[model samples]
Target: MKRILGLSLLAVLTLASCKKNEAAETSTATTTTEQKDPFADDRVVKQSDLVSEAKNHAETTLALSEPDFNFGKIKKGDVVEHVYEVTNTGKNPLIISAVKPGCGCTAPDYTKDPIMPGQKGQITLKFDSTNFDGIVYKSAEVYANVAQVPIEIRFSADIQP
Candidate 1:
């Protein structure tokens, strides 16, 4: 009976040691199998690139007052005003601190106040295509708190001279 008891204790210790070794191996395996960052570009992006990215990020949040705007036909030397109604669909309040046109020929005006969640705003685009003719493509770039992707609200005006 004594010998049998000693053998039983040894068997229990062996089983416990095996379980501990298995737990350690499982932990090691899990740590080693952790997913690595695939796109780990450590090199710092240039200031210009950062600025460009930030500009793009702002653009994305400036949900256009309208998706597609078309000034079908306008005579030369005509100034037209088109309003784009937009809503803040992002997590943060949409701020249209500034709206810069691509060129002086086109002018863009947006709401100065910050648009809260589910709130609406407007961006009016005025195109003075006096001497300009053909298919006029205009863009209104809104500067504000935007998503990771940059947003550019664009419209087109076709002027017939």
Candidate 2:
């Protein structure tokens, strides 16, 4: 009976030692993982920083006469048009690079020539609400060589089906 008790005590000691080793290994692994950073070499740039940089490097500044337009109420299959004015409010000339419509239903026309400092330009947006019903919202993006290059003009209308 004494030999049996000794063997049982030895077994218990072995199991307890194994559990301690396992705990030690788990703690080491967790510490190693916590010490490493996934993005250690990479830096994240903020949107406000990018905007500030763009503004700082921009030669010209663009000011929109109207940023939003309301068509009020319109019937289906009606064509609506609006001219949005852009002014160069900086020391340098403003050059419009492109005008992109949000969808195929919108037609955009803009001044091809560069507007000198203190001059004005225009963007003509024509929206056809043939297939659109209910409340319709559309946007046009203007790309220019200015501080606010990609400017969005939003227009909305309550469509009568």
Among these predictions, the greatest lDDT belongs to 2
Q: C-alpha displacement of 109 in model 2, angstroms? A: 0.1
- Model 1, runs deviating above 4 Å: 1-62
lDDT (10s digit) by residue, model 2, range 60-127: 88888899999999999999999999998988877776565666678778888879988999998888
- Supply the TM-score for candidate 2: 0.63
What are the lDDT figures for the candidates, one per model? 0.65, 0.74
- State model 1's lDDT: 0.65
- Provide the global lDDT of candidate 2 against the true structure: 0.74
Stretches of candidate 2 off by over 4 Å are 1-58
Mind giving the per-residue lDDT tens digits that candidate 1 earns over 1-161?
A: 99999999999999999999999977754332121112222233333343353454333344565656899899999988788887888767676655545556666676777788788998887778897888988775554656442246677878897
Tell me each candidate's TM-score: 0.58, 0.63
